[model samples]
Target: MKLLIRNLSRATTEAELQAMFESFGAVQSCNLVKDKTTNKSKGFGFVQMVKNGEAKAAMKTLNGKDVDGFKIRVKRAEDKPTEQPLQDAE
Candidate 1:
């Protein structure tokens, strides 16, 4: 299961997130969104867990919890809308 984590600390690191979630279960991946220009954290991230139950547990424990001096928000990831293919213009 995938989880969206928001309001992350500016100093949050992928390793820290992975370590935090390890207490719950196996985490498949931890990604901290970064800015294209500065390569700095966007103050948000996505975490993919091996099981849905584990993800849910992590969300419950982590949401509204302070980490690295910022209150974090965690939730089940929502499906992104698929983009339609562009039609050729005459």
Candidate 2:
């Protein structure tokens, strides 16, 4: 299960996020969005849990929770459709 975490604290690290969710269940992966130029946190990230139930539980306990003065929003991630170019007409 993929979880979208938003409004994360700037100082939040991938490891930190993983640890937080580890209590709920096994974490497949945890990634914290980083600024391309500054190489710093973008204040958001995604967490992947191995089980759907665990993901839901984590969301329930984590959503709207404060970390380092920032309130985090956690929810199931929406799948993004693949983009394609328009076909050329004869």
Each candidate: what lDDT?
A: 0.92, 0.93
lDDT of 1 by residue, 1-90 (tens): 999999988888999989989899999999999999999999999999998898889999999998978899999999898999999999
Q: What is the C-alpha local distance difference test score of candidate 1? A: 0.92
**Positional deviation of residue 34's Cα in model 2 after best superposition, in angstroms:** 0.6
Q: What is the TM-score of each candidate against the true structure?
A: 0.90, 0.91
Top candidate by lDDT: 2
Model 2 lDDT per residue over 5-88, tens place: 999888888999999999999999999988899999998899999999999999999999988898899999999989889899
Model 2: lDDT to the true structure: 0.93
TM-score of 2: 0.91
Q: List the residue pairs that clash in candidate 2.
A: none
Model 1 Cα shift for residue 51 (angstroms) = 0.7
Model 2 misplaced stretches (Cα beyond 4 Å): 88-90
- What is the Cα-based lDDT of residue 50 in candidate 2? 100
